[model samples]
Target: MLQQKSKLAHFFKSASVIKILPIALLIIAIFNSYFIVNEGHVGVVKRFGEAKDQQNPGLHFKIPFIETVEMIEVRTRKNAEKMASSTKEQMPVTVEVSVNWTVNKEAALDLFKRYGGLTQFEQRILDPRFRSATKDTIPQFEAEQLIQDRASAIQGIEHRLAEEMEGFPVIVDNIQIENIILPQKYINSIEIKQTEKNLAAAEEHKLERQRLEALRAVNTADARAKGILKVAEAEAQSILLKGKAEAQAIEAKAKALKNNPLIVKLTEAQAWDGRLPMTMMGESVMPIMDIRNANESN
Candidate 1:
């Protein structure tokens, strides 16, 4: 133990240890003095609990342990608040309001100076203003109108909130009503009406389909009747043409017989069977003779 103590004394007695002790402390101090602001944040440097200046993103330096940096986000942020209010018709509605906001880098120090921090600023001033804006705007819209035209309701709220947030260190990028709770009775009635409307539409469509089918049937009947008439007319025309053809042939035959009466005698001689008929129709029939040869020979 005495040897270890002597070695420690000898180590502390060295000149290098004396030199490095101050350097090590200086290095630690320097490392702690510089602060890094992230890519999307701005640093609020405070000197003795008072706002001094704002620093943009990147490496920055400050007196060690004297100046402290608070990173205030300059990027856009979103938050929602649900509140109850009455409509223009005195109907109560619950609305969930959302606000998108960003800190102005230039006024971050001023914001820190005024509200001490961003959280305090939002909780104390912004929240009240938001509630006021909602109260003022919700009265302008009836409960039914709010349900039917939510865009208009949101616009009214945004406009009023924008006016309220004027001159603040933050810019109100946008405001939205995330959800609106309508009265249950109204919703039920709307659902019933929608159901009736759907049923009526279905009935109308069915009637339209049936009307089309009836028209189609009528057209089919008409087409079929026209087709039958056409076939009948074609048949009648064929019969008439056949009758005319037969009459022409008969006329030719009659003209030939008139020009040559011996053709009739030749026809009768050719038709004779060489057997006498047992009976006659109205009078006695004569036996047919070959007159052509007889006439020619004479």
Candidate 2:
């Protein structure tokens, strides 16, 4: 009975030892099999170095030691780069560009299988293609047009870049032209040209003002001369009218004398004073002597 009890105890100890390792290992494996995928990220599951599936954000399960989970950020990504290129006029220009992009969520697995992650994809494909597209599109417009018409140039570049990166597993949200820089010499020359043009316009305006003033002066002088001529013509007409009136009066008087001779004798008798005339030369007789002879005869 004692030996049987001892053998029972030994068997129980061995069984406990055998049970501990597996439970510990199983706990470890269970911990390692699941991972938490944070929000704004997608998990790519790789089986034996080959992508098999993609998992959205949340808790995800995988075969321990057989499958690996790589969490790729599927959110929008932004990158800014400065590139130097020439315009259609061959003028050197520097452009600072910003690109907003993201991995196509539905094609995340394919993207991971094709190009591992964002870093590799950007370096290998996105950056070079962006640079190439910018170079290709910039030369189609002049420097002045690029500055003056920035919207069209940006649209062109975005379209061309999208076409260039068409087959890739990434989606381009937008391309922004942050800023454009021109050579200092060109900028200075442009400013100088603008200044000269402004000066020329100012001079032309001054000349136009002077011409208008001169024309106004000539108009005023002409108006004054016309007024003076009108006054002179009115005075001449007045003098002519007065002369015609005097001539008509004189002719009427002459016709009255010819028509009636008694009018001349009546005018002479009205002109005589009480005193006798100074001279009566032919057959003159005294009026006082006739009165005396008439009184004596009576």
Candidate 3:
């Protein structure tokens, strides 16, 4: 009977130890599975399907059975989508859109818990929402707008997507319309429209150039007029100086004439040089006489 009791005690002790063994192993496993959140990534923690907290880029720990941690990448991610839709004017068009986005690190836990976990968030919420939003927004814009005002359309869609994905805890940094695919008809039409616009712009530029040229001509004419006035003023000043010199010379000459009476006679005698003309009456000719010598003889 004592041997049976001893055997029963040994069995009970072994059973209790066995029961605790799995728990200890599980604790060891949890501690061993420590993860490091990489740069630009956040880790999400959950306790029995309930969100607990988010972990930044570093070492982190969690309980073995009562708590579990799932690392979710919150880094910037890029996605591309191509879509075909009808415009507001019922024009069929195709487009390719590229999106740059990142999961919000601060709302990692809330994102995992509230939105049916990470898988569901991507599959159910993000994909469908993106398709639907792109379809709705593209159809509201014209094909020409899709081609010409692409940046504006992209901005509008990005804003709307940011609002739609608000609760999903994803931030859309930029949404770019990479390519606008259209039928040949639409392409031809757009090309023609662009050509016409370019022609109009060219004409406007020509008119502007002509206007500038005309203004330049007017300025040149004004400058020429000023130059002519300056030249005329300089010539008038030179002529006045010449006139003054001539007047002074005439006054000096008159003063000399008043001071010397024989001056006129002397000038007359000087005017009669050796080239004296012979006097002729009919056929008879007389030799020229020297009036100064005759006057001296008289």
Candidate 4:
């Protein structure tokens, strides 16, 4: 009986370890089943290598061995790339591009099923498609047009990329053409051409100003000549009028003298001094005697 009791105690001790081991394993499995899905992320539940369900942020439970969860970020993402391409003029150019994108929430299952992950999706679809679209669109513009009309080129690229990326699980929110790099030779040539054009415009403006000045000087000189001519003509007319008046006055005086001969004697008497002339010969004295009598009578 003593030996049996000792064997029973040993058996109980062994059974106790076995029971505790299963409970500990069950606790571990329960802990592993429950997981926290963080904010900005969605949990994709896969069962037997197939997507079965999706879970939002917080605590979630699933079959331990048969089910697994993958957290996919559904936030906006940014990517930048530089591509080398040629223009219509066959000039080599470097185009830097920035893309803002996001994975569509409703399409997350399709995305996971199709590409397995964001990295694969970008590598297989987004990057190659973007580069191809840019290369295809760039050759439509010349180097000069590409530089001068950059907005148009950027819009074209964005539109083409959007078209190509259609039906994909990713949404391209915006595309930006950050920078364009032309060859050094082309840059130098463009600078020189611009400088020459500016110089030509300045020269043309200067010539126009000089022509206006010359026209103004000519007009001024013509006005001065006309004034001088007008003054000379007026002076000549005044001189002619004075000469005609003087001649008329002289003719009138001559007519008056002819009509009255006594006027000349009166003019001579007024001019003579109060004195008598002396006789020189005998005949002159006889004539002088009449003059002396006339004087005594006066």
User: lDDT by residue for model 2 over 1-298, one digit each (tens)?
Assistant: 9999999999999999999989998998898899888998889988898888899999988888889888888899998889999999899899999899998888888888888888988998899988888888889999778877898888998989989988888899688889999999888987888799999999999999999999999999999999999999999999999999999999999999889999989988899887864444556565333354567799
Residue 116, model 4, lDDT:
91
Candidate 4: segments with Cα more than 4 A from true spot: 1-20, 196-298
Please give, for residues 61-130, the per-residue lDDT of candidate 1 as tens digits.
Answer: 9998789899888889887899999889898889999888888888988888888777898899888888
Candidate 4 residue 273 C-alpha distance from true site, Å: 61
Residue 89 of model 2: what lDDT?
A: 88
Flag regions of model 2 displaced more than 4 Å: 1-23, 194-298
Model 3, 279: alpha-carbon shift in Å? 36
- lDDT per prediction? 0.88, 0.88, 0.81, 0.88
The global Cα lDDT (0 to 1) of model 4 is: 0.88
Q: What's the TM-score of each model vs. the native?
A: 0.60, 0.59, 0.63, 0.60
Mark the 10 consecutive residues where model 3 has the least summed lDDT: 275-284
C-alpha RMSD of each candidate structure in angstroms: 9.5, 11.4, 8.6, 12.3
Backbone clashes, candidate 1: 0
> With candidate 2 superimposed using the best TM-score fit, by how many Å does residue 278's alpha carbon deviate from the native?
65
